[model samples]
Target: MYSLTNNQLYSMPKAVRIFASSALSLGLTASLIFYPSASQAGKNDTGVPAELQGEWRYGRISSIQYQDSYTGQSAAPNGSSDQFQLASNGNYKRNRLLQINTYNCASNLFIEEKGKVKIEAQRLTFQPSDSTSKGQICNSGRTYSSRNTAKPETYQWSIETNEYGQQVLVLETADGKGKAHYGRPQ
Candidate 1:
């Protein structure tokens, strides 16, 4: 019968360890060469999909100047600039004015409008507000006692792989009215 000491049994030859490690590494490499990792295995299963869940600075509206031909006068001659910000926490603010010019002699004016919006997935709903409007020349103005002016708006958004292997976000309004392209921040 053959007997081995504890140290002898526990200790392994350096060459044997090296050969074993090399074989194991080679096996792993071969497996990787043949079969992809779980992450690279399937389409639409690229893990949790990217969402439009972040703070976004959607540019700015500037140079909103208007002039009327009949009066040969400028109402908002200096014009104004404003910003729009959207957040993932279902919160949005448009600290700006939507300029709608009659492009006529009467030259009505609308100013100081602000509102909040909520966003979910691809859908967006805006809290309604009073439609307060004013007439410049005629000195006639009225405030509509209404909460929501229009319907709750919804849209579709998507994340796509770009040419650089990076993900991008594409947004389209529900009514097919507007579309926007965006990319992840650096």
Candidate 2:
């Protein structure tokens, strides 16, 4: 019932038209990315494994905590907490809080990401839901990969019990450049 005439669209300001077009494209893309297609919606729901369903947390952890990464080395030294929550419906979320402790002050920086994930043959694959910028700052737009920027990060995961007898979520990057250990939250 609703339609836009070519003349009317052409009459709008160029910037307005571009913005509207971009907005519509982004909305369509988001919907397609986040929703399952008709043929795959409900026939079989292959969710993540049971032991990996709850919340897994890291940081505030000692250098000697869980097995570092797949290589068994400790992760980089940083003041941050990483939490991962894998739901029953294959939906997953990860929240990272970085604390910058200066000589006399402290600031908190946080980033959140969500997507659908599933386990197959003992391996967990994350389909990241990040679709935008990594920072909210006005000028620099410094990446969120550090203490001051908003960075979008990703990882592959697994369930493991550390030497300390605690359940841990082992996460590593696809290239093996990054690794982390998140213990079962107490």
> Which candidate gets the maximum lDDT versus the true structure?
2
lDDT tens string, model 2, 1-186? 001234433544454344323322211100111121122222235655666677887665223233334566533332556677888888877775543322322233455667777565545665656522122221233233322222333456655555565556666655554456666777
Candidate 1 local Cα displacement, residue 91, angstroms: 4.2
| Per-residue lDDT of model 1, residues 1-186, tens digit only | 011122322343443233222222211000111121123122222122225444332222224455676778765432222233444333444332222233432222232223445544344444424223222332233222222232333456555554666555444555554454455556
Candidate 2 positional error at 164, Å: 2.8
Against the unseen true structure, what C-alpha lDDT does each candidate score?
0.34, 0.47
lDDT at 135, model 2: 21
lDDT, residue 167, model 2: 59
RMSD of each: 29.8, 16.7
Best TM-score among the predictions, by candidate number: 2
Off by over 4 Å in 1: 1-51, 57-71, 75-96, 103-139, 148-151, 159-170, 180-186
TM-score of model 2 vs. true structure = 0.50
